[model samples]
Target chain A: EPEVTQTPSHQVTQMGQEVILRCVPISNHLYFYWYRQILGQKVEFLVSFYNNEISEKSEIFDDQFSVERPDGSNFTLKIRSTKLEDSAMYFCASSEARGAGEKLFFGSGTQLSVL
Target chain B: AQTVTQSQPEMSVQEAETVTLSCTYDTSESNYYLFWYKQPPSRQMILVIRQEAYKQQNATENRFSVNFQKAAKSFSLKISDSQLGDTAMYFCAFMVNYQLIWGAGTKLIIKP
Candidate 1:
Protein backbone atom coordinates (compact mmCIF):
# COMPACT_ATOMS: atom_id res chain seq x y z
CA GLU A 1 0.00 0.00 0.00
CA PRO A 2 1.11 3.56 -0.61
CA GLU A 3 2.27 5.33 2.56
CA VAL A 4 3.49 8.72 3.63
CA THR A 5 7.26 9.11 3.55
CA GLN A 6 9.49 11.49 5.52
CA THR A 7 13.15 12.33 5.05
CA PRO A 8 15.90 12.40 7.67
CA SER A 9 14.59 9.65 9.92
CA HIS A 10 16.51 11.36 12.73
CA GLN A 11 17.71 14.95 12.99
CA VAL A 12 20.04 16.65 15.44
CA THR A 13 20.35 20.42 15.51
CA GLN A 14 21.78 23.08 17.78
CA MET A 15 19.51 25.25 19.84
CA GLY A 16 18.61 28.59 18.15
CA GLN A 17 19.22 27.08 14.71
CA GLU A 18 16.56 26.66 12.09
CA VAL A 19 15.26 23.20 11.15
CA ILE A 20 13.05 22.04 8.37
CA LEU A 21 11.32 18.62 8.38
CA ARG A 22 10.24 17.28 5.03
CA CYS A 23 7.43 14.93 4.09
CA VAL A 24 6.17 13.45 0.85
CA PRO A 25 2.55 12.60 1.28
CA ILE A 26 0.75 9.96 -0.72
CA SER A 27 0.41 11.07 -4.28
CA ASN A 28 -3.37 11.22 -4.27
CA HIS A 29 -3.86 12.58 -0.78
CA LEU A 30 -5.49 15.98 -0.48
CA TYR A 31 -5.07 16.71 3.20
CA PHE A 32 -1.83 16.67 5.17
CA TYR A 33 -1.03 17.05 8.87
CA TRP A 34 1.88 17.33 11.28
CA TYR A 35 1.93 15.98 14.82
CA ARG A 36 4.57 15.72 17.50
CA GLN A 37 5.16 13.62 20.61
CA ILE A 38 7.59 14.62 23.30
CA LEU A 39 9.23 11.64 24.97
CA GLY A 40 6.68 9.96 27.25
CA GLN A 41 3.93 12.37 26.20
CA LYS A 42 0.84 12.03 24.11
CA VAL A 43 0.99 12.90 20.43
CA GLU A 44 0.00 16.51 19.89
CA PHE A 45 -1.37 18.05 16.73
CA LEU A 46 0.67 20.86 15.22
CA VAL A 47 -1.05 21.87 12.00
CA SER A 48 -3.23 20.71 9.13
CA PHE A 49 -2.97 21.70 5.48
CA TYR A 50 -5.34 21.54 2.56
CA ASN A 51 -5.59 23.38 -0.71
CA ASN A 52 -2.09 24.78 -0.14
CA GLU A 53 -3.16 26.60 3.05
CA ILE A 54 -3.34 25.89 6.73
CA SER A 55 -6.72 24.67 7.80
CA GLU A 56 -6.12 24.41 11.55
CA LYS A 57 -3.31 24.75 14.07
CA SER A 58 -2.81 24.28 17.78
CA GLU A 59 -1.59 26.79 20.32
CA ILE A 60 1.81 25.13 20.28
CA PHE A 61 2.13 26.10 16.62
CA ASP A 62 3.31 29.59 17.43
CA ASP A 63 5.38 32.20 15.59
CA GLN A 64 8.41 29.92 15.30
CA PHE A 65 6.51 27.25 13.36
CA SER A 66 5.40 27.36 9.75
CA VAL A 67 4.40 24.80 7.07
CA GLU A 68 4.74 24.92 3.33
CA ARG A 69 3.85 22.83 0.30
CA PRO A 70 6.75 24.05 -1.79
CA ASP A 71 5.95 21.52 -4.49
CA GLY A 72 3.00 19.36 -5.47
CA SER A 73 4.47 16.40 -3.58
CA ASN A 74 6.62 17.87 -0.84
CA PHE A 75 5.26 19.33 2.41
CA THR A 76 7.69 20.94 4.78
CA LEU A 77 7.57 22.18 8.38
CA LYS A 78 10.07 24.89 9.26
CA ILE A 79 10.97 26.01 12.74
CA ARG A 80 12.55 29.44 12.62
CA SER A 81 14.48 28.89 15.85
CA THR A 82 14.71 25.61 17.70
CA LYS A 83 14.63 25.11 21.46
CA LEU A 84 15.31 22.20 23.80
CA GLU A 85 11.62 21.73 24.34
CA ASP A 86 11.17 21.33 20.57
CA SER A 87 12.94 17.99 20.64
CA ALA A 88 10.41 15.30 19.89
CA MET A 89 9.22 12.75 17.36
CA TYR A 90 7.61 14.67 14.51
CA PHE A 91 5.14 12.69 12.38
CA CYS A 92 3.63 13.41 9.00
CA ALA A 93 0.21 12.09 8.06
CA SER A 94 -2.03 12.28 5.03
CA SER A 95 -5.55 11.37 4.06
CA GLU A 96 -7.36 10.88 0.80
CA ALA A 97 -10.20 13.05 1.96
CA ARG A 98 -11.39 15.08 4.94
CA GLY A 99 -14.20 12.70 5.71
CA ALA A 100 -15.02 12.08 9.32
CA GLY A 101 -14.35 8.35 9.12
CA GLU A 102 -11.44 8.39 6.73
CA LYS A 103 -8.21 6.99 8.11
CA LEU A 104 -4.97 8.98 8.06
CA PHE A 105 -1.79 7.21 6.93
CA PHE A 106 1.24 8.15 8.99
CA GLY A 107 4.94 8.06 8.23
CA SER A 108 7.55 6.40 10.41
CA GLY A 109 8.27 9.82 11.99
CA THR A 110 11.41 11.93 12.28
CA GLN A 111 13.04 12.08 15.67
CA LEU A 112 14.26 15.62 16.27
CA SER A 113 16.96 16.10 18.87
CA VAL A 114 18.08 19.59 19.92
CA LEU A 115 21.43 20.12 21.51
CA ALA B 1 -12.55 20.54 23.22
CA GLN B 2 -12.22 16.76 22.71
CA THR B 3 -10.01 14.63 24.94
CA VAL B 4 -9.13 10.94 24.74
CA THR B 5 -7.94 9.13 27.86
CA GLN B 6 -6.19 5.76 28.03
CA SER B 7 -6.02 5.20 31.76
CA GLN B 8 -3.78 2.15 31.69
CA PRO B 9 -0.17 3.13 31.30
CA GLU B 10 1.00 -0.41 30.54
CA MET B 11 -0.23 -3.99 30.21
CA SER B 12 1.25 -7.45 29.63
CA VAL B 13 0.00 -10.69 28.11
CA GLN B 14 1.53 -14.04 27.29
CA GLU B 15 1.69 -15.21 23.73
CA ALA B 16 -1.60 -16.75 22.56
CA GLU B 17 -3.47 -15.07 25.42
CA THR B 18 -5.87 -12.19 25.08
CA VAL B 19 -5.64 -8.60 26.29
CA THR B 20 -7.86 -5.59 26.30
CA LEU B 21 -6.86 -1.93 26.35
CA SER B 22 -9.32 0.61 27.67
CA CYS B 23 -10.01 4.05 26.26
CA THR B 24 -12.50 6.81 27.03
CA TYR B 25 -13.09 10.21 25.51
CA ASP B 26 -14.91 13.48 26.13
CA THR B 27 -16.52 14.82 23.00
CA SER B 28 -19.70 16.83 22.54
CA GLU B 29 -19.99 16.06 18.88
CA SER B 30 -22.36 13.23 18.00
CA ASN B 31 -20.78 12.25 14.73
CA TYR B 32 -17.16 11.21 14.81
CA TYR B 33 -14.64 8.40 14.45
CA LEU B 34 -12.42 6.39 16.79
CA PHE B 35 -9.14 4.66 15.97
CA TRP B 36 -6.51 2.48 17.58
CA TYR B 37 -2.90 2.93 16.45
CA LYS B 38 0.13 0.82 17.33
CA GLN B 39 3.60 2.27 17.64
CA PRO B 40 6.26 -0.40 17.70
CA PRO B 41 9.86 0.03 18.80
CA SER B 42 10.63 1.55 15.42
CA ARG B 43 8.17 4.34 16.30
CA GLN B 44 6.10 3.78 13.22
CA MET B 45 2.47 4.60 13.87
CA ILE B 46 0.30 1.85 12.35
CA LEU B 47 -3.47 1.90 12.22
CA VAL B 48 -4.95 -1.15 13.90
CA ILE B 49 -8.67 -0.62 13.84
CA ARG B 50 -11.35 2.02 13.44
CA GLN B 51 -14.97 2.52 14.47
CA GLU B 52 -17.54 5.02 13.36
CA ALA B 53 -19.57 6.50 16.20
CA TYR B 54 -22.84 6.16 14.36
CA LYS B 55 -22.42 2.42 13.85
CA GLN B 56 -23.90 0.13 16.43
CA GLN B 57 -21.85 -2.92 15.56
CA ASN B 58 -18.33 -3.22 16.82
CA ALA B 59 -15.49 -3.09 14.31
CA THR B 60 -13.16 -6.03 14.01
CA GLU B 61 -9.98 -6.61 12.03
CA ASN B 62 -8.77 -10.21 12.09
CA ARG B 63 -7.29 -10.77 15.57
CA PHE B 64 -8.04 -7.19 16.63
CA SER B 65 -11.48 -5.97 17.60
CA VAL B 66 -13.03 -2.97 19.28
CA ASN B 67 -15.81 -2.56 21.83
CA PHE B 68 -17.12 0.85 20.97
CA GLN B 69 -19.78 2.26 23.28
CA LYS B 70 -20.75 5.48 21.62
CA ALA B 71 -23.30 6.54 24.21
CA ALA B 72 -20.80 6.12 27.03
CA LYS B 73 -17.97 7.59 25.00
CA SER B 74 -15.82 4.54 25.58
CA PHE B 75 -13.73 2.53 23.11
CA SER B 76 -11.64 -0.48 23.98
CA LEU B 77 -9.32 -2.71 21.94
CA LYS B 78 -9.15 -6.47 22.41
CA ILE B 79 -6.31 -8.50 20.98
CA SER B 80 -6.90 -12.21 20.61
CA ASP B 81 -4.26 -14.91 20.22
CA SER B 82 -1.62 -12.35 20.80
CA GLN B 83 1.82 -12.70 19.29
CA LEU B 84 5.16 -11.24 20.28
CA GLY B 85 4.86 -8.83 17.38
CA ASP B 86 1.79 -7.40 19.06
CA THR B 87 3.96 -5.78 21.69
CA ALA B 88 3.75 -2.08 21.05
CA MET B 89 2.44 1.21 22.37
CA TYR B 90 -1.24 1.56 21.62
CA PHE B 91 -2.92 4.92 21.28
CA CYS B 92 -6.63 5.57 21.20
CA ALA B 93 -7.63 8.55 19.13
CA PHE B 94 -10.85 10.32 18.33
CA MET B 95 -11.71 12.53 15.41
CA VAL B 96 -14.28 15.23 15.93
CA ASN B 97 -14.95 18.62 14.43
CA TYR B 98 -12.24 17.92 11.84
CA GLN B 99 -9.45 17.40 14.38
CA LEU B 100 -7.81 14.35 15.91
CA ILE B 101 -7.50 14.03 19.69
CA TRP B 102 -5.09 11.43 21.06
CA GLY B 103 -4.93 9.49 24.30
CA ALA B 104 -1.86 9.25 26.45
CA GLY B 105 -1.22 5.66 25.24
CA THR B 106 -0.96 2.12 26.65
CA LYS B 107 2.25 0.16 26.36
CA LEU B 108 1.40 -3.48 25.70
CA ILE B 109 3.97 -6.22 26.13
CA ILE B 110 3.38 -9.68 24.72
CA LYS B 111 5.84 -12.17 26.20
CA PRO B 112 6.77 -15.40 24.46
Candidate 2:
Protein backbone atom coordinates (compact mmCIF):
# COMPACT_ATOMS: atom_id res chain seq x y z
CA GLU A 1 0.00 0.00 0.00
CA PRO A 2 1.37 3.41 -0.95
CA GLU A 3 1.63 5.86 1.95
CA VAL A 4 2.21 9.57 2.45
CA THR A 5 5.61 10.37 3.92
CA GLN A 6 6.52 13.46 5.93
CA THR A 7 10.07 14.46 6.75
CA PRO A 8 11.38 15.65 10.12
CA SER A 9 8.80 13.78 12.18
CA HIS A 10 9.30 16.47 14.81
CA GLN A 11 10.20 20.13 14.44
CA VAL A 12 11.12 22.73 17.05
CA THR A 13 11.57 26.43 16.41
CA GLN A 14 11.45 29.83 18.06
CA MET A 15 8.11 31.66 18.03
CA GLY A 16 9.22 34.17 15.39
CA GLN A 17 11.10 31.74 13.14
CA GLU A 18 10.10 30.41 9.75
CA VAL A 19 9.35 26.72 9.21
CA ILE A 20 8.69 24.50 6.25
CA LEU A 21 7.00 21.12 6.57
CA ARG A 22 7.45 18.67 3.75
CA CYS A 23 5.27 15.83 2.53
CA VAL A 24 5.55 13.29 -0.26
CA PRO A 25 2.10 12.20 -1.27
CA ILE A 26 1.28 8.89 -2.84
CA SER A 27 2.49 8.62 -6.41
CA ASN A 28 -0.98 8.34 -7.87
CA HIS A 29 -2.80 10.79 -5.66
CA LEU A 30 -4.12 13.94 -7.32
CA TYR A 31 -5.43 15.96 -4.39
CA PHE A 32 -3.38 16.96 -1.36
CA TYR A 33 -4.27 18.54 1.98
CA TRP A 34 -2.80 19.93 5.17
CA TYR A 35 -4.52 19.57 8.55
CA ARG A 36 -3.53 20.33 12.11
CA GLN A 37 -4.55 19.00 15.52
CA ILE A 38 -3.83 20.95 18.63
CA LEU A 39 -3.08 18.81 21.64
CA GLY A 40 -6.33 17.30 22.95
CA GLN A 41 -8.41 19.00 20.27
CA LYS A 42 -10.21 18.00 17.12
CA VAL A 43 -8.41 18.06 13.81
CA GLU A 44 -8.71 21.29 11.80
CA PHE A 45 -8.41 21.66 8.07
CA LEU A 46 -5.74 24.10 6.95
CA VAL A 47 -5.59 23.90 3.17
CA SER A 48 -6.15 21.70 0.16
CA PHE A 49 -4.12 21.75 -3.04
CA TYR A 50 -4.51 20.38 -6.52
CA ASN A 51 -3.04 21.08 -9.94
CA ASN A 52 -0.25 22.99 -8.21
CA GLU A 53 -2.58 25.59 -6.69
CA ILE A 54 -4.73 25.92 -3.59
CA SER A 55 -8.29 24.70 -3.92
CA GLU A 56 -9.60 25.85 -0.54
CA LYS A 57 -8.30 27.02 2.80
CA SER A 58 -9.68 27.57 6.28
CA GLU A 59 -9.70 30.85 8.14
CA ILE A 60 -6.90 29.42 10.25
CA PHE A 61 -4.80 29.48 7.09
CA ASP A 62 -3.88 33.12 6.88
CA ASP A 63 -1.27 35.29 5.22
CA GLN A 64 1.37 33.74 7.45
CA PHE A 65 0.82 30.35 5.89
CA SER A 66 1.33 29.11 2.34
CA VAL A 67 1.42 25.73 0.55
CA GLU A 68 3.27 24.75 -2.59
CA ARG A 69 3.55 21.67 -4.73
CA PRO A 70 6.93 22.67 -6.06
CA ASP A 71 7.28 19.39 -7.85
CA GLY A 72 5.09 16.57 -9.08
CA SER A 73 5.59 14.55 -5.90
CA ASN A 74 6.39 16.90 -3.06
CA PHE A 75 3.97 19.23 -1.26
CA THR A 76 5.24 21.72 1.26
CA LEU A 77 3.73 24.14 3.80
CA LYS A 78 5.65 27.21 4.83
CA ILE A 79 4.94 29.48 7.76
CA ARG A 80 6.54 32.85 7.18
CA SER A 81 6.59 33.63 10.88
CA THR A 82 5.46 31.11 13.42
CA LYS A 83 3.56 31.99 16.57
CA LEU A 84 3.30 30.08 19.82
CA GLU A 85 -0.25 29.12 18.89
CA ASP A 86 1.16 27.36 15.81
CA SER A 87 2.37 24.48 17.99
CA ALA A 88 0.42 21.44 16.86
CA MET A 89 0.63 18.17 14.99
CA TYR A 90 0.56 18.89 11.27
CA PHE A 91 -0.81 16.13 9.09
CA CYS A 92 -0.39 15.63 5.35
CA ALA A 93 -3.00 13.73 3.43
CA SER A 94 -3.67 12.75 -0.16
CA SER A 95 -6.39 11.12 -2.18
CA GLU A 96 -6.81 9.93 -5.70
CA ALA A 97 -9.81 12.13 -6.30
CA ARG A 98 -11.74 15.07 -4.88
CA GLY A 99 -15.03 13.19 -4.55
CA ALA A 100 -16.81 13.42 -1.24
CA GLY A 101 -16.67 9.65 -0.89
CA GLU A 102 -12.96 9.30 -1.57
CA LYS A 103 -10.85 8.16 1.35
CA LEU A 104 -7.68 10.07 2.23
CA PHE A 105 -4.36 8.56 3.19
CA PHE A 106 -2.65 10.45 5.97
CA GLY A 107 0.98 10.71 7.00
CA SER A 108 2.19 9.93 10.50
CA GLY A 109 2.23 13.70 11.13
CA THR A 110 4.90 16.26 11.93
CA GLN A 111 4.74 17.59 15.47
CA LEU A 112 5.67 21.29 15.28
CA SER A 113 6.62 23.03 18.45
CA VAL A 114 6.96 26.81 18.41
CA LEU A 115 8.65 27.82 21.60
CA ALA B 1 -23.34 25.29 9.35
CA GLN B 2 -22.45 21.59 9.42
CA THR B 3 -21.16 19.89 12.53
CA VAL B 4 -20.28 16.36 13.57
CA THR B 5 -20.65 15.35 17.19
CA GLN B 6 -19.23 12.45 19.15
CA SER B 7 -20.95 12.71 22.50
CA GLN B 8 -18.63 10.33 24.30
CA PRO B 9 -15.23 11.64 25.15
CA GLU B 10 -13.83 8.29 26.23
CA MET B 11 -14.85 4.66 26.61
CA SER B 12 -13.30 1.39 27.74
CA VAL B 13 -14.16 -2.21 26.99
CA GLN B 14 -12.59 -5.57 27.81
CA GLU B 15 -10.95 -7.43 25.00
CA ALA B 16 -13.20 -9.81 23.07
CA GLU B 17 -16.24 -7.70 23.89
CA THR B 18 -18.20 -5.63 21.44
CA VAL B 19 -18.06 -1.86 21.66
CA THR B 20 -20.06 0.87 19.97
CA LEU B 21 -19.07 4.52 19.48
CA SER B 22 -21.83 7.00 18.85
CA CYS B 23 -21.77 9.86 16.32
CA THR B 24 -24.29 12.34 14.97
CA TYR B 25 -24.21 15.27 12.60
CA ASP B 26 -26.34 18.25 11.59
CA THR B 27 -26.54 18.96 7.90
CA SER B 28 -29.08 20.28 5.44
CA GLU B 29 -27.57 18.71 2.35
CA SER B 30 -29.24 15.45 1.36
CA ASN B 31 -26.19 13.92 -0.27
CA TYR B 32 -22.94 13.51 1.64
CA TYR B 33 -20.49 11.00 3.05
CA LEU B 34 -19.81 9.92 6.62
CA PHE B 35 -16.54 8.39 7.78
CA TRP B 36 -14.92 6.89 10.88
CA TYR B 37 -11.19 7.44 11.29
CA LYS B 38 -9.01 5.76 13.90
CA GLN B 39 -5.98 7.43 15.44
CA PRO B 40 -3.79 5.37 17.66
CA PRO B 41 -0.84 6.60 19.68
CA SER B 42 1.06 6.91 16.43
CA ARG B 43 -1.27 9.78 15.49
CA GLN B 44 -1.85 8.40 12.04
CA MET B 45 -5.37 8.77 10.73
CA ILE B 46 -6.65 5.45 9.42
CA LEU B 47 -9.99 5.04 7.75
CA VAL B 48 -12.22 2.55 9.53
CA ILE B 49 -15.44 2.71 7.58
CA ARG B 50 -17.58 4.95 5.39
CA GLN B 51 -21.27 5.36 4.64
CA GLU B 52 -22.97 7.08 1.73
CA ALA B 53 -26.16 8.97 2.45
CA TYR B 54 -27.95 7.58 -0.57
CA LYS B 55 -27.21 3.98 0.34
CA GLN B 56 -29.75 2.39 2.63
CA GLN B 57 -27.54 -0.63 3.31
CA ASN B 58 -25.02 -0.17 6.05
CA ALA B 59 -21.31 -0.50 5.30
CA THR B 60 -19.20 -3.15 7.01
CA GLU B 61 -15.55 -4.10 6.97
CA ASN B 62 -14.60 -7.38 8.62
CA ARG B 63 -15.43 -6.90 12.32
CA PHE B 64 -15.97 -3.21 11.90
CA SER B 65 -19.42 -2.08 10.91
CA VAL B 66 -21.53 1.05 10.90
CA ASN B 67 -25.17 1.60 11.75
CA PHE B 68 -26.04 4.60 9.62
CA GLN B 69 -29.38 6.31 10.18
CA LYS B 70 -29.80 8.81 7.39
CA ALA B 71 -33.05 10.44 8.50
CA ALA B 72 -31.83 10.71 12.08
CA LYS B 73 -28.44 12.01 11.01
CA SER B 74 -26.70 9.32 13.01
CA PHE B 75 -23.67 7.20 12.16
CA SER B 76 -22.19 4.94 14.80
CA LEU B 77 -19.24 2.55 14.64
CA LYS B 78 -19.38 -0.95 16.14
CA ILE B 79 -16.27 -3.02 16.75
CA SER B 80 -16.87 -6.71 17.30
CA ASP B 81 -14.45 -9.06 19.04
CA SER B 82 -12.47 -6.06 20.00
CA GLN B 83 -8.76 -6.38 20.50
CA LEU B 84 -6.19 -4.18 22.16
CA GLY B 85 -5.12 -2.94 18.74
CA ASP B 86 -8.59 -1.53 18.34
CA THR B 87 -7.86 0.98 21.08
CA ALA B 88 -7.60 4.47 19.65
CA MET B 89 -9.26 7.84 19.31
CA TYR B 90 -12.06 7.61 16.77
CA PHE B 91 -13.28 10.61 14.82
CA CYS B 92 -16.52 10.90 12.92
CA ALA B 93 -16.42 13.14 9.89
CA PHE B 94 -19.00 14.46 7.46
CA MET B 95 -17.80 15.06 3.91
CA VAL B 96 -19.50 17.80 1.96
CA ASN B 97 -18.28 18.91 -1.44
CA TYR B 98 -14.58 18.07 -1.06
CA GLN B 99 -13.94 18.93 2.56
CA LEU B 100 -14.48 16.93 5.71
CA ILE B 101 -16.12 18.38 8.80
CA TRP B 102 -14.86 16.48 11.84
CA GLY B 103 -16.19 15.65 15.28
CA ALA B 104 -14.17 16.15 18.43
CA GLY B 105 -13.55 12.39 18.69
CA THR B 106 -14.05 9.54 21.14
CA LYS B 107 -11.06 7.87 22.80
CA LEU B 108 -11.55 4.10 23.00
CA ILE B 109 -9.56 1.89 25.34
CA ILE B 110 -9.54 -1.86 25.00
CA LYS B 111 -8.36 -3.48 28.18
CA PRO B 112 -6.98 -6.97 28.37
Point to the candidate with the largest lDDT.
2
lDDT of candidate 1 vs native?
Answer: 0.94
lDDT of 2 at B24: 94
Off by over 4 Å in 2: none
**Which tens-of-lDDT digit does each residue in A1-115 have in candidate 2?**
8899998899999999999999999999999999999987878899999998899999999999999988888999999999999999999999999998999999999999999
Q: For candidate 1, what TM-score does chain B get against the true chain B?
A: 0.97
> Candidate 1 residues B1-112, lDDT tens each?
6799999999998999999999999988878899999999987789999999889999999999999988788999999999999999999998875677899999999999
Tens digits of per-residue lDDT for model 1, A23-113? 9999999999999999988899999999999998999999999999998999999999999999999999999999887889999999999
lDDT of model 1 at position A47: 95
User: Could you tell me which residue pairs clash in candidate 2?
Assistant: none
